[model samples]
Target: MSKLQIESALEILLQSLQSNSVMSKTFFWNYLKVFCKEGFLVDLQTLSIALVEKQAVFLIDSIACLDYKAAQQLDILVLS
Candidate 1:
């Protein structure tokens, strides 16, 4: 799509997100982050498709381990 059209669609999505009745802030916040991180925000169609895909959710603290032992601890928590 043209730049103008893409901008318009994003504006509409933003408006919908801003509406209290239609959007969940937590869900949208996570979704927006993932979309930007995965480079899925360039086209509206891709965003629409990605939104429906399976998503992984885990506690931020649970995934914080950097060393092998720490990772094992996190992995145990995840498995348990």
Candidate 2:
């Protein structure tokens, strides 16, 4: 994806997360997989803040689906 596309997608994902959508949690998990594969760097602090703000179980479950390496790189283990 182009940089603009990634940024747009991130915005959408963050909105979905903020709304506490269960399907968006799955989308976030899948997007994270793509980020890991494509070597994209997400803003961990922003994402963490969104997750914490929602306090959703589906969000936590999505974090559980992340692989160790990706989780470590994203520093998202704290969310799980």
Candidate 3:
């Protein structure tokens, strides 16, 4: 996908997350895993910063549910 398309998709996902709607933890983590496996670095970075800035407790809790591999991938993305 083009960079613009990736960014747009991430924006939409972020909007959904910020909407205060209830999202299942399993589903949310799975969505994030997809993004990580697809190597959506920019999107992940944007998402990480947004979640941190917003102090998203949901995000923090979800991190604890991640498997080792997914957590490692996310750690790399966040630390890079």
Candidate 4:
């Protein structure tokens, strides 16, 4: 895909994510990190694809933006 096409697709995804009800927006991102750490690449990709189908979204927390609230642990999801 061209640069513009990729940007457009990401823009659509970002807009869709903005509309979803986020239960701790970082939930899925933290889950992704843990999954990758534990070597669940295939499982994570499969489940993420399924969630994207429903427009589910996760906003990752960055260390540079750390604050009192950010210090609190985010909700982590464990998939069996």
Instruction: Give the per-residue lDDT digits (tens) of candidate 3, residues 1-80.
Output: 45555555455445566656466444545676675466654345555555555545244334446445544555665556
Highest TM-score: give the candidate number: 2
For TM-score, candidate 1 versus 3, the one ahead is: 3
**Candidate 2 overall Cα lDDT vs. reference?**
0.52
The best candidate in terms of lDDT: 3
lDDT of 1 by residue, 4-78 (tens): 543444444455456676445555555545534453334434333322231222322222322234334434544
Candidate 1 vs candidate 2: the lDDT winner is 2
Clash count of each predicted structure: 0, 0, 0, 0
Lowest lDDT 10-residue stretch of candidate 3: 55-64
lDDT of model 1 at position 48: 36
At residue 23, candidate 3 shows an lDDT of 68
Off by over 4 Å in 1: 23-80
Residue pairs with backbone overlap in model 1: none
> By descending TM-score, how would the candidates be arranged?
2, 3, 1, 4
Q: What is the descending lDDT order?
A: 3, 2, 1, 4
Candidate 3: deviation at residue 48, Å?
Answer: 11
In Å, residue 71's CA in model 4 sits off its true spot by 27
lDDT of 2 by residue, 7-36 (tens): 555565566666567787777667766754
